[model samples]
Target: MEQAFGLVHHGTATVGGRSGITANTICCDVCIVGAGPAGLAAALRLADLGRDICVVAPLPGDGNRRWESLTPGAWKILDALGLGTALAQSHCLLSHAASVSWGDREVNRDGHAEVTFLIDRARFDACLMDAARRRGVRLLTPAVASRPQKIGDAWLLPVTTDQTTVSLCAAHVIDASGRKALTGSRRHRLSPATLALCARWRGPPAPPGVTRIEATAESWCWSASLADGAHYAAVFVDPRSLRAARDEPATAFLAAVGRSSPRWDGTLASPVTACDASASRIARAPGLEDTIAAGEAALSLDPLSSQGIQRALVDGQQSAIVVNTLIVHPERRRIAVAFHAERQAEASRRDSAMCHGLYREQATTYQSPFWSRYCGQDTPVEHQLRSPVPLDNLLPETRLRLSPRARLEDTAVIDGDLIALAPALVHPELDRPVAFLAGRSIGSLLARAFSGASAASLFDGWRADSLPEGTALELLRWFWQRGLLVDSSATDAS
Candidate 1:
């Protein structure tokens, strides 16, 4: 690792004309501040591109167990890394069912289709770090990139360890530092406060073909049987609403588990651990100083979706591409940054809305401050979904206006507060939701589409990226139902 960084010793250093410690300065292509899953994944990919990489992180220990499951989307990355056999050898458990306990009844969403995997987060991460190391990733663990500085087009990071501090210089910086970004930039929290307490267990095989999800009076629980004859149980609750022994989280975890529906119960036998499993409140920010934050550092999803690991792996991949573009093709940096920002913002909205919907569905009858506050917002997932709209029934004299609450771009989602969409003229030559239409926002486009144009005339020349006759109407219906596209006269009358 030292050889890769081109380490050089400066025998003596003086500061303020006082005694100072020795220093070593090294240079690399890219420097990663976090060595967890996100950092390692990015390092592996960056190395594949033949980039010199240096990673500064704390040594992985018991903390890795906090990440236990991987949604199926992660398989592609594992396969690409040739870790499919390693993953298979790791005794990863496959779960076919995604069931939820809404109120008192249990509902299985997947009907037992194979999808999610339960693996040892500790082992999986260790394997990833090992793979990255083998690929020439210089890891300096038990070290901190606590502060990084930008000197011209390069980044200078100060890494501190027990023995000495090392200086790392790189052309680009990747902040895979999870939520506590090394840059100390704060993220916005979208949902009401929530956290998870998870514990491991050894138990009998769970019911075939399903992972059980349960919602209780004050919290939610998820228990999955692992491939290696073990099980994992996690409980989600608002810390304020929970008044349990902070020192004995295992007992609190057990008590919460006991309250869940009994369909997939397992005996709790391992020590419990608590961690923040909240969806990232921080929306993906525009690229700054060529530094990119990936995974939880970029956007943390709700655990209810169980897609964090997969998202992290994918985020790392995307971050690598972004970093590569910035270094290899500086002219394309603007395009790459825009794409990353849009993708991340969309993911954040999806996670927020899905979580809101999941909690809202469970709280329809039961009334509790815990659920009420988080589920109180309107979720736009159902609204964003494509459904049939009847543009054929439009009145020639009818006019439309963008809803006061609508915001648009090329890609759109229901943010907690307003509807977000991207405006683009659908054309036959374009891909789905194709190229950015300059100066287009949802409101302006909708206003122009129906402005003084007859219903037949509006539909006559419309070519929105290969929409079947009925599909276009459905898109309009989705917006109309949500009041994103409203009748001008009707709105004025009201």
Candidate 2:
């Protein structure tokens, strides 16, 4: 390895099978911070392009496990990079519709949709790192990087480890450090809108279809059987809710779940062995400079979107394309701008629609006094109807107008009084509920309920009555009327 890089080791020590010397510094074309999905993906892409790439991440034995979502496209990228086998063996596929219920009625009014995968984040990340190593990407573990400094035409990075402090220089630096850490100008720091609480369980395999059920007062919670033979469930709640539960105990949280949705009964009864949680949201101003951000660093998606992993994979691929293009043709910076703009527009549309629905639901439930005050029935429809603002617009001042109870920081929302308004404004696109039943006809509304009643008990009260073929078509028509799904028949004919 030293010979390939034309380096001489000073001592009789070996590292990653290479006899190394005393030098602690290194240099490469690209220095990627954070070894999570985004960083690993970037390194692999650069390596494939034959560029020298160096990746720094917290060491494997460092005992800090990162959390991540693994989508279908992300899995495909891993397969292309020769890590698919490892991922397939270590992650869980979520193959069912998710919903929320106040009583017997489903909050999301839709029927059924596509599913995503839930992964054992630590194992999955390790697989990606290993794949990068096999492809000649230099790997540095147990390292923490300070804010990157721009020096002349290159980037200077200082990293600290147990042994010593090391400095490396690179042409460009990619910030994939996620939300906990970031580099570049602090122009666009937005407070987080919500806090999430997650936990894992060991139980019987989840039913064929995995569903995530969320309530208004309680945070978004999900459960799925993992590929590694374990069950997992997590809740994303308001910080106030977490605080309230902190003193009460597990039963209080579980009781909150029971009030929101019937699905929690099974999980509440199961023995929970592990709990993991965090708060997340997009950067408000993402600043201006030659540097670009991707994944959580670029924009944090609501976990309810279930598109977290999909967005990361897409961002990684698109960012690589943008970087390579800029390297070869410095004049076409517009290409990168256009790329980011298109994505921004798409994300804006989705965020606005989802937040609107969530807010409306909260208003209806009157889950807590906090929610009731901000989402009071008398709140103006215009405020509720306001276009889903880009995360940038959801700043402290803006959020205050939406909800008077929130506390905002430069980068995180320390208090979540305002986020209560999020449920009121959640978009209809996101709130629509879906279910999958294996039958041919729409039977009696009650009978349909019985066909799949057993499973319905697992989720909210979803019944599996058969629908007449024509009725099924009408249901699709209703969904189209509501703007949930597109009618592509015309486009297909064209």
Candidate 3:
């Protein structure tokens, strides 16, 4: 066996079956649906933890030719997955800047601050799938898996390939099958339904190393050059806007692209692909008794955040941990499920809030239906949005207390490679259950601060509690910014 990227090569994948509950059934510790980023990431992590992982993948070359710009942060996660050399070999294009024209402002960002890469999503996903296979994951390629049915303690998934159909019986299932998911029902719509019209171009060249994003009156458009020298442009708009030109999707795509950036017109290399770009989440808890939904199967965010792949990769790792806990420590199964559910909800809320805020800002500059729809009052935020109290307003003699809308709760959190219960500070403005910040426990910090103590007294107490020099003031600012801490006087006045 050859070793590549720290993975043991099992030569080539064969179309055979592994013995499961029955002789003909394929059995494993975990059955992962979809071979995209999330599923593959989970497969690799689960395999690392000494679990048998079976990944159901589409046939080779069966992915969309979408182009995505990977931030430096996203690249770090991919690199950790042993894709550094693979991506370089795939000729991923590195860019040093981006051009944005939005909200009455046009700015060019230089890569001196941070660099990014434009990658073909199809090739990127293939690289991840290959990496997972090399790491000893059993892959059912050229296969489609149906929704899993519970049988006894295992979930049985029916997989169909070109040759035959087989049953994959596993102790747990991780669903990462993208929008048309194989598992998990009851989805909650986060943003208004929107569609993306995308196509590849080969005629004209864009800036050598720049990605252009421009906002139009009724839609937003972006274009970037791929590693293979082809240019890609996409326009996102309301689905209803395209009903009139239903038969001419390509024409509507070109027209929409021209409205924002007219210079991007070029010879089409592929037909216009219209995909749902709306933000949504699985309303039901992602982790159930023996199944979990990772990546887009759990929560899909608006493309405006440019975090689709990043979130998928992160969820993969988290889901693996939750699954491991459910199987290894069955007594904590509920905690693991609730932890993953809360995390997904937190992600949905944070991403939706950011997207809505941006749309509202853009709507102020361009009065269009596209922007107006997101500015409405369908936000998922827990409580009414309130401005943060200024930290400078807190005097040394001023007393402080927790915000009325926030509280400390015993939350399930990730400890090492398992889910554990811990004290977390929860607030409507917060993205997740925050248990620690700046190496200090949130519960202890709050306990010392909420004792009717003055600002100076809190600071002195925190320092006495072994917080570093100037750490007390920084912690105070952090709380004030998140609206986790408020003035006692203000509460009394109200």
Q: Which has the greatest TM-score?
A: 3
lDDT of 1 at 441: 41
Per-prediction TM-score: 0.72, 0.61, 0.82
Write the residue-wise lDDT of candidate 2 on 406-444 in tens digits.
121121110111100011112244321122122321122
Report the Cα lDDT for residue 296, model 1.
Answer: 81
Question: Which has the higher lDDT value, candidate number 2 or candidate number 3?
Answer: 3
Cα deviation of 377, candidate 3, in Å: 5.8
Give the alpha carbon lDDT tens digit for every residue of 408-429 in model 1: 4454322221223446434222
In candidate 3, how many Å is residue 492 off?
6.4
| CA lDDT scores, all candidates in order | 0.66, 0.52, 0.78
Model 3 over residues 385-427: C-alpha lDDT tens digits? Answer: 4676666787888788888888888889887789988789988
Q: TM-score for candidate 1, please give it.
A: 0.72
Against the true structure, whose lDDT is highest? Answer: 3
For model 1, how big is the CA root-mean-square deviation?
7.8
- What lDDT is reached at residue 364 by model 1? 77
lDDT of 2 at 350: 63
